[model samples]
Target: MHSSKRKHIVVPLVLYCPLATFANTNPVAADDRLETVLVIGEQIKAALQAEQALTPGNVTVIDSADLYQRNIANLGDMLRYVPGIWTASGSTGDSTFFSSRGSNLDATNYDGNGIKLLQDGLPVTAADGNNHNRIMDPLGARYATIAQGANALTYGASTLGGAIDFTTPTARDTEPQIFLNDGSHGQLQGRVTTGLVAGAFDGLITIESKEWDGFRDHHQQERKGVYANAGWQFDDVVKTRFYFTYLDNDQELPGALTAEQFDENPYQAQPAAVIGHYQYNVETWRAANKTIFDINENSSLSVGFSYEDQTLYHPIVYSPFFSLLINTEQKNAGTSLRYNLHVNDHDLLAGINYGETTVDGGNYSHEAGRRKNMTTHVKNNADSLEIFLVDRWQIAPRWKLIYGVQAVSAGREVKNITVADGTLYNPGADYDSINPRAGVIYQFKSNNEAFANVSRLYEAPTNYELEDDSSPDNKALDAMHGSVIEIGARGKRPLGTHNKLHWEFSIYYAQLQDEILSIDNPTAPGTSLSTNVDDTIHAGIESLLGASFSLDANNNHRIEPLLSVTINEFSFDDDSHYGNNELPAAPGYALKGEILYRNSNGFFAGPTFDIIDERYADFSNTYTVDSYILLGLRTGFTHADWEVFGEVRNLTDKEYVSLFSVRDRAAPNAAILQAGEPRSVYVGMRLQF
Candidate 1:
């Protein structure tokens, strides 16, 4: 069952219609396309241009241009150049897992523990507080910003490690663009975007579709989506906009590999696994309305409301011998409101959000060509509120001081109903917490900045973690919390008359409480379950450096080089079970570097390299994965009304594990490992008018 309340209001368009036409709405000019084009290396610049002042923090922007240049097809591929972020490739697809400053990657089971993912400023994680399998739809994204530690206080909820915001294209200009790509493994993708502008009124529409045969056996995925945006500006004082998106996806589940299978062949897919019979399908609809009011020339206020509905289903095989069958369904809805205010040198922001999720399913076992069934249901609800303030004070003509604080309150409730032994067991629990953040930054010159801050964030145990009533009653195990401290600096310098260099570096430390840990409890003294442990700490350093140089007499021909790296140290503080051990899926170091050459004719070419140090599969550090490196190349050309590009990923054909096996004891039981994809290539063309 689903329930919600709403109040509808209609505004007369007669008064605003004529004004909309005279509002100087140049659709393409007002849009963020150009901003997206420079996002990858100029994220800080874009933020500054948007009036988002940064203190001594590490922030990175990944623009559409970077994505195109690198042929990034998924989150893993896109984040390879971002320091402090680690990605794992599984048979199913790509997953991102990371530790910032010294937080355990598994503290909350790697489902976006220390980081938050926002789609157009709305949370995309499910009610369970996990975003592991969620596809971000890179094809639909215009720009993304990653802010680390306390620097992310501007956004509410989960800011211990960082916050990531992915903004879609808005109606600002009038243009039409199309893109197509074909790659190995039967992979293909297509996208189209069009815009219209009439005075102060503008609109944009986009559609994208993709299909892939996958690198592993029995693995296939298909996805498609449409998005639309409309906007109206009432002079320089006020503006309003609407956005909507619809998506559908279907994929095959390939399951995890066994340890033996891993030792024999890390790239082999399990053909006879029960998981091979499973398929997952999902559908989502989202809409938002936003308003910007200019309180005056120096201050503005922003408010918005967003709603999203998502449905998912998975058909699974229950047993290997008997060939049992089961299917599960999940539905979710969420709403949020936010406001922004700027006055003098101070900025203030606040927001509130709420969401509801429900799961229903039935289990069936195949016996003598007959089906035996069981039914179940689960529900969860979440609510949150956040408030923050930031100030940029000019202490002197050449120095600036920045500071801010944020407070957040969050709560969740979960309910589960399962039929067993002719009786239905109904159990539920609720968890809640308050988090706080504060940070400061100092600017020494136009090209230099430094800062430090401390923040507290928490993760409510997922529905699955606490839904079982058989577990011992332990309040301390209900939630995970982390406290982080960080300091860093960034600056740019002219290396020559026609060359400029920029660099950013940061170091952080974190202390965690009631960290969740998964255990093998097959023969435990009580019911087999995953539970929480207490006291852990993680720390690390993250850095980025780059330079741009003119290659010819005309500044139009240039070369840009970039490098990024992250190193982490993770350990359990109170228990000996995992003392002084690296967290699972936590890579100790990663390096990414690239060089790009561009000419005046709108042509560009680049080569890239990605390297990762060894990592452990578990907290015990008993099993280790060796380091690996990958090479890639891409080139693009733009003519009067057309643009074309091609890219090759993993050109060296390196084999590595992007994701670890969560089902260590499951059937078809290869070693609980999932292999990485092989070498692949993609080519595409686009037209605009």
Candidate 2:
């Protein structure tokens, strides 16, 4: 462990004192009022608070208030607004996947290649660092934050694309909340959350249940989950928390449809030979403790330890006649220690982390009768250290330079076992990389700033990619490396007397080396192999505009509006079978806009639109899917402690595909489209006390 404590002092001299006196002697501008200084100081304090929490890097925070306001139904829906994220659903609720940047959901075998999912700071992926889309549970999400790429090194897991942390409710207050809703497609949902706080003890619990008949034929789903959290504050230096979550879900998985099928009857079911069914059940328990020690006024040290246990059973229909059943049990335990030092103009953060993982599972390859059972066991051990230094320097009267560098060293090892044949394999791999990041912000007149940043990041290979068994001769694969350049500007301004506007515009370019690709060997059609490709490039622009206004006394109304757009271009640079084709599952553009209104009488109404451009289902781009737009409306009223709300989705009853299938090579040929949800209406009420 490295100590981050340091001391700083200014030399006292006549010349230096004279310069300081001259600087103070300068007259202040009229716009530089005391209140302005106070506001700026407050903002700086807030930023420092975030930095001190070891939450540096490129991070986005989505609070609970925003979740309720959006009425998000699932994990995919909840993350739709995030930049550089792509989500698709094959069935109503059972088949869903999420990808970040230009990566495909089904392509990467590593858990951290394009994205990593976490609950309460613990990884949710398998021990081999593979993420199973069918087992993602989102019913208990209270707050979430996302960190992109190598910036997420502190988590000590697969974080190639980035890392997402979902925070559940904590028991530190006395409150109770309930929500209910019913909508189109025979959808119904209910949720409850309650918490209690007494002296140094606090606890919270949540329960959620949802059911839907689904939009397409034979597409139905049932879901139920519960989460509980308890914490004890043992004085001001030590705190411990316990968390538990469980979920049971059963659903019908509707396969994709052909282009003709999509146009003719988007809600029609696939043939019996192609219909698929899936069921998933999971239970997880976690415990974490935090201890903070203040050595002095400007320096502090904190230590944390966490452990998690999870078990899952997933069965999916591979074809109409066959199904694959997978049973998994995983355990992860880790500890982290961090020290923070705050100086007059600089802050330093350093931490060390260690973890171990154990996985025991097997796959059943047949639908009925003495099915072939393949059991596997694997273990991973990791150790890492990271350090960061940031300086908030006042270059001039209105300019500040923010610069930082993060250095990390990590090593991981995997041990795998094959049950049937009693074969064993041990692959030990280790790598170290230095990620340097720098940015500058110039404060102009009014409340405006211009900022730009460039960073270098590296991604390691996942366990699956290292030991897929598909390639017997090639057991070693290189890691993925990339760099990103970003430029953006954001500002807040007041419009007239009753409104305010805030907006941001950014453009980024990313280049990846040693990009992983899974291809079918030319001589061996049935066996697919994984290897690193030459290169790939992704470029995109993202923009957001938001405004809020207040109305006159008679109406006593408030209105808030937001709009966002993203344009992306993803391509490969290689001479392979695919040839300069568009990356699969990468949408060209996405647009979303919404308006919300509230009146003094406790009435609210809002309308929203979500649109996605045409996209390809495969790298070859041989097949194309038509683009679609969806319309939704929501309204509600509240009286005292009771509230009622309703929402209608797909109001026009337009049919479209929610997901596309690129793997099936039958009649669909190039692509198979899954129908989107049809028009549905839901009404619900909630009481808070």
Candidate 3:
């Protein structure tokens, strides 16, 4: 098999090391060891700060304190202000299509790649690097950490886009709260959370539900979920926590529209979507446990175990009479062990991660989402073992040396039983790699630092790319590799008694080999092909700048302005068919900015804008989508026990392409574009005690 290469631009990587010492790095005195109680929230924060300080690569942390005041309907709403990341709403369900470092630019919104998604420092993405967007809830997290490029090696993720980890709060940091929201298109949602503590035991639980009648026809969605956790502290040096989660999500697919169709009526569903009743339904259950122990005064160990089971039912149509139905059951289990040692201005971290995933399912010929006949039975399995070591040495008072390496062994196997097709192309593959990282950091003054790093990245093909029934020519795909270098600086300065300024900037370049790409078959309306490119180049600049100042001498009124920009230059490096051509789907530049006015009475209002440049839609650079700009407004009021917020999006009712399918070549009016949402309004409120 061979292939070619989203639009909303995304880019780059940088360094963000917190200025905190490792938790428990110093021994506790004997007199202070009696009648001690551990605060879970503070401990976790301190530990994470300490861990991130040793990372020599880019990292961004999003706190929940200001997020709740925004209209957070999906992941995009929460991550919009983060530099080097691009997120687009799917308009149906709670789905969000996101990209980092130009990863998975051509993949469909239903599936994601390159990025590793995690929950509470545990792996949520499958062993083969597949993740579902609808199953994630942004409101459930206390904070989120985005580690770009080689920074993710700490979590055993070796992908180009890196890793995102969402941390949940325990009972000690939780309060009884209720939330409700009502928005345009018949949207309604509700959530309730509570926590309890008894002596050394504490527990927290949350339940949420949502229903939406989408802006497009045949695009209704529904979701419900429960998240719960319990913790126990036996002593000052040992503690453990248990977690459980369940989610049920169902959504209707509106399918893509041709350029002409989009111009006529962007909200109309595709004819195939209506006739085939395209839909996706999923149910999942997950459980995990983490324990920490202080081995001695200068060392600590952390162990984690996780299990997940999921069921999926999806039906789609390729043509008038060619419909497909997929029913599958997937199970995944994983374990992780991390040890930390601090000695004489040196910090050493070593870890091992093992994961196994199994998928059993069958594909069937379908009519209007109903199974008519079985076509193929599938049994796919994947497993991975990763070992990593990192050491941060302070060579001088103002400088440090950081180095790390990760070794991985992975395998993928597919066994299928065919019914109608007379082809037996069951394939299995094994991959092994040792990626290394090196960097240096220099401290100029308090609250200011500069860093640089070079690292190797690798990613193996997922099972979905290998088990294609539409084409017998689909052979086993090879893993992609890349070498990258990045440099960055970050700091904050006090402007005055009531004002401050902060900024972060970085640039990165990656020379990639055998870059995997998936593109639509130009001859077919809905079919796509996958292949590897011989050579490619990805480079970008990422920046975040913000400031706040008092509007009056009394400091009763304040104004805040923030800006984030990404510049990308992704292209083919003298390829055979497309010589020095720009890659499709990712824009050349993107900018997001906002200005807010805040009063002493806890009221705030802001205007936000986003701009995305024009981009190509095919590898040959024959077709393109025009640039687009969006405007929005947000207003909110916050208090100690409750909050209220309102939002208006797409204020100009702009009609533009939100996403599209990739292709090797395309016609003038190809059926590849997905329309963006129209104007809408939302209001929400929360109460806590």
Candidate 4:
């Protein structure tokens, strides 16, 4: 699943369809669509929230408001406050890597594969389960749902880390605006968005351009993108929406600097990066649609399909004589069908999602920027078909039992056209897995609930991970499988007339077989090697607490304190060499907190802090990435249709590593670390009409 490209596609942000724009053009149509909006709003938000609460596993729904005006640059920063999700980024806004509850515990690179990413409940992650962060545009989304662990069975997401579905906004929530941000590191951002409605159709579109002179030398970057959606209603019972997007991205690679180099000149590029002009470039196009049909008062059917095409060009220094040059084209297509039924006290959902992705790739031997010769060429293809069923039964007014299952069949095949060594390729394999989940939710009181669940998950090896060139076996690697048991409680309630509290906490433990471990290729910088461990254990605790207080009349003055933490314990169950050793890159503790204040006159301010415990940098546990703390502040003013925000990151100007690479071994002088961004300031403004 890992390509070492460190980029995540941002397509999902454009895949959502919100047709409310059309109803706004005509008063009669507006009134006609109002009923549909009310019903669909539940389909888009409230119902999803209610469904999430019914899951015994940890699940969360985040509104776009959480990041809309916060100067979010990427998913890494976008998900900073989220629990159980940890990210390691190469630059302030570059590509990022993530791990949820130690799921890919030893992954040391930026490719996010273990976590399932969806666009409006359809696959954004490719057939092999690899997802790049390029498809997401934070400001263009309506909200997102995070289903942790087995709770993702409804989406047929069998990965240990679960799944995320990002929904887009409708005309009702749209505000046409122009925005810009100019800040430290010679960064500049400009964007324009518009929404409109006419008759039975609605449409919204956004265009953006950005450039950054990066914190490090020779790491300049530029990007241009367009996102748009149009939705139409044929009649009261049938409606369809279409999505389209285009993105162009080019980023210079400063590569990694050694610890000593980081302390000396963190802004300097790696030697190879400077000499070979290392970089990555991408061009993409995507189109998708979702249509809903009201089957009856108590049931509805939804169907969707999408297609995407991408071109990638990358050059990296893998060795002194032969840096790797990659030219590839990827095509992806998927379709989804889901039926929702609510009959009496029973709720059921049945769905089938299918996707296929093909890669036409070529590897080359290069000197500087020119390819000296072709190494190999191949067509690698993967496909996935999944059927899932979930049912929630109300046994009593306050108690409910939920059960779900997913049947998945997946295959990966590679046809090599050039002569290559055995270890350089794998014929690939096919896999079938059955995942089952059960949970119970008990409402102890208003706005409060206790829940528990047990589930099993399975994840197959990705195309890249099957690169065990040493074996001629069609299936070079085995699938990773696991079972998890979890219990938790969550709720929100008012303590007094002027104060309110919201809290949630959960603990989970899992036993796994053939757990995958990402091992660095010591001989080639940035290259990876993955293998399976016989047995492993993963456990974690996640919690969030927030309290709000109103201090004056009209409820204008308000104050709040927010706290979040995650504790992880992942280790080898038994191994002769590692011997019950904790997994590398798994932080023992990570915490975030904030104190915020707001005035009735549309003014607000907040100070936030993040702290991470020391983490092992390798399997041997001989080297480590030290703990670091970051302090930041955000202030904003919103009056009528005008919005202004200012953000200061690393208020202390503390120099640190926002993220680092884990490998077979590490040293002070090797290229294995990325310096955290220096203290920076960003000021932004948006005007809506």
Please say which candidate is ahead in lDDT: 2 or 4: 4
Q: Model 4, 347-382: lDDT tens per residue?
A: 998999999999888877677656666677867899
- Candidate 1 global CA lDDT score: 0.62
Candidate 3 local lDDT, 523-634, one digit each (tens): 4445456677899998899888999999899998999999999888889999998999898887899899889999999899999888999988888899989999999998
lDDT of 1 by residue, 49-150 (tens): 344335546777666644654455677767766777766666554334444443335423434555667776666665555563466776567777777755
Superior by lDDT: candidate 1 or candidate 2: 1
**Poorest stretch of ten by lDDT in candidate 2:** 1-10
Candidate 4 Cα outliers beyond 4 Å, as residue runs:
1-43, 416-424, 468-474
Each candidate: RMSD: 7.4, 13.4, 8.2, 4.8
Off by over 4 Å in 3: 1-50, 107-109, 468-475, 522-527
Give the TM-score of each candidate.
0.84, 0.81, 0.92, 0.92
Candidate 2 C-alpha lDDT tens digits along 1-689: 01111110012122223432232232443234223334543454455335323332344555543455445567666776666666776465644566666654333421324665666655554333456432555546656766655445444432445677776555332135666656666566666666655567767666666776677776667666667778777766656676676666666555556677777887877653133334454555666665667767788777777777777665543544345565667677766676768776555555655555665676555442123565555554544444545455556766656555656555556566767677777665776676666656666655566666666656555555665434465355666677877666666798877789977666777888877655433332222356676778777776777898888746479898888777888877663655576666667998877888988898889997889998866556656667889999878887655678777777898787677554312234422567777787777776554
The alpha-carbon lDDT assigned to residue 599 of candidate 2 equals 86
Cα error, residue 221 of model 4, in Å, equals 1.6
